[model samples]
Target: MLEIQFFQKIEFLQHRLVAVKKSVMVKTRKVFKNLSCLTVISYKFKGENIMKRCAIVTADLQNAAANKHAARIKAVEAFLPEHTEFLNKMRAKGIPVVHLQQIYDPNDPRKYKHTDYDKKFIEGSHEAAILDEVCQESDIIVQKHRDSGFYDNNLHDVLQAMNVEVVILTGMQSQICVQTTAADATFRGYEVLVPSDGVSATKPEDTERALDWMQKYVGTVKTQKEIYDDVLAGELIGGKHT
Candidate 1:
């Protein structure tokens, strides 16, 4: 009878050890699950809060000098250095830079209707390529056939994914692609900032008119210098000036 009691006690102790091991495994899993959730939350918060919620959107910085838009190329090149410097600074701050490139689809029947100069911009052509001065391997490239970068494209989605709140417009043809994009961005509830010196047109008057229109309806119009100042002052994204 004593031997029986000893064996029974041993069995009870073994059962208790198994139960304790199961409980420890369950608690460990719960702790790890909670830690995983916390890590994701922390990463999201850092992306949306700690970093600037602003992006630089450049339109059509291509080799347009060989096309009918040669004047547009010249106009953009004049301020290209300033835009490049601003892009570098923004990149250093972890701000996103999106480049809009006009690439004509050669497979489309519409290609037959375009002028030879326009044909030079067909996909894989030299003229269709983004300018080396402003193009970066790390920058997001959005190939477009329409004037507006957001037209039937994923540009808006890209911005939304980055949690961008404000968009600074730059590049050639201020009266066309830039203006249209500004309007679209406004419609999508993004604050627009057009740098007066950063955009250009075929003529000086067109640039001025586009800037005025954008200021009245789309968003604010400021020079690159002024905008950079705002960035330095912590006013680019969610600060007082934004």
Candidate 2:
């Protein structure tokens, strides 16, 4: 009887130990599950708060040479509303806007290219300045030579400093500066968005051709309204207002 009682005691202790081990495993799994939930919540919160990395590049919107071109005037007249709204909205959203001016410096190798055109935006000419109506005080100015705004300008540096991975472009001479800049941005591994109504050239057909080329090989061509909605939704490069 003594031996039997001793065995029963051993069995009872073994069962108790098994119950304790099972309880520990259950608690461990619960802790791990809670930790996973916390991690997911943290990730979502971080994403929600992070701002988007994008910049707006407005190329060659200066009044100088633009004033001499009848086609440019007509093109701009049709889309001024879109340009105005987009510029103001970008400013309100605190997006960095780069205003590109084509200042044909006399010493530039490309100066010969502009000899046939009207004289304006000649390096330091007041006419080289962007239109007062479209410009806000917060805008950054980048004076460039030739058709591309990136030529001899601080555009790349500015974009890099802002950590911009996307460039939203608008402004004059769609077939020249705007289109060329869009292609260059794509070559540099940046996604570009060109609003169809936001960019213009001396000729409407020329502008459309440039837009088509960008859509095919350079960037995404969207309407101003679509761009505004996406920007508001935080679907573009950086974060939007919460």
Candidate 3:
């Protein structure tokens, strides 16, 4: 009887040990499952949120023919065809194209009150329209009344939604609209790339000054061909801006 009782106690302890081992294994599996889920979430948050790395922002390239800034318009027009080809290549690579249109209200207090210059840019005026040579119906258009494209406009939101980490800024009036836009873009945390030949000013000195300022404090200044080649070779998209 004593031997049987001792054997029975040993059997009970063995059964308890097996049950405890099973319980530990279950808890371990649960912990590992939770860890696996967290790993997936981490990857998605870092990798999938930013779908695109670059966008082309053309600011205030409105009706060139009616524009009074003859010298600036002439400079921009010279490179329009080449710029359009660069845009085409960027578009083919699935980069977003954004055009900024400057529209002024005749009665708005912020408009230029001294000259009739603002009159041509009034809403629905021919001079306020974006150029057809560079803009397509499918492209995104952001209208603003100020020199800065981001001033009280949805441009930032649009770029955020597109996950654009870098902006290829191009347009008219290098020292005014383009410069302001580039500054704003830098403030908003987007890497800006201004093509030297893609933007213009009424005078060559003004253009040089704006480019130098932007390069020193705001963003990089490269030629249209250099930027186009990088875009085509996928170098810009891969976080290689130099």
**Model 2: how far residue 138 lies from native, Å:** 0.4
Best by TM-score: 2
- In model 3, pairs of residues that clash are none
Candidates 1 and 3 compared by lDDT, better number: 1
- The Cα error of candidate 1 at residue 159, in Å, is 0.5
Deviation from native of the Cα of residue 208 in model 2, angstroms: 1.4
Q: Residue 104 deviation, candidate 2, in Å?
A: 1.8
- Residue-wise C-alpha lDDT for candidate 3, range 128-155, written one tens digit per residue: 7888788877688888878899998899
Error of 2 at 132 (Å): 0.5
CA lDDT scores, all candidates in order: 0.71, 0.70, 0.70
| Superposed model 2: Cα runs more than 4 Å off | 1-51, 114-118, 237-242
RMSD of each: 20.9, 19.9, 20.4
C-alpha lDDT of residue 121 in model 3: 73
CA lDDT for candidate 2: 0.70
Q: Lowest-lDDT window of 10 residues in candidate 2?
A: 1-10
A best-first ranking of the candidates according to their lDDT comes to: 1, 3, 2
Across 113-158, the per-residue lDDT of candidate 2 in tens digits comes to 6564535667677777788878888788887876877876788887
Cα lDDT over the full model 3 = 0.70
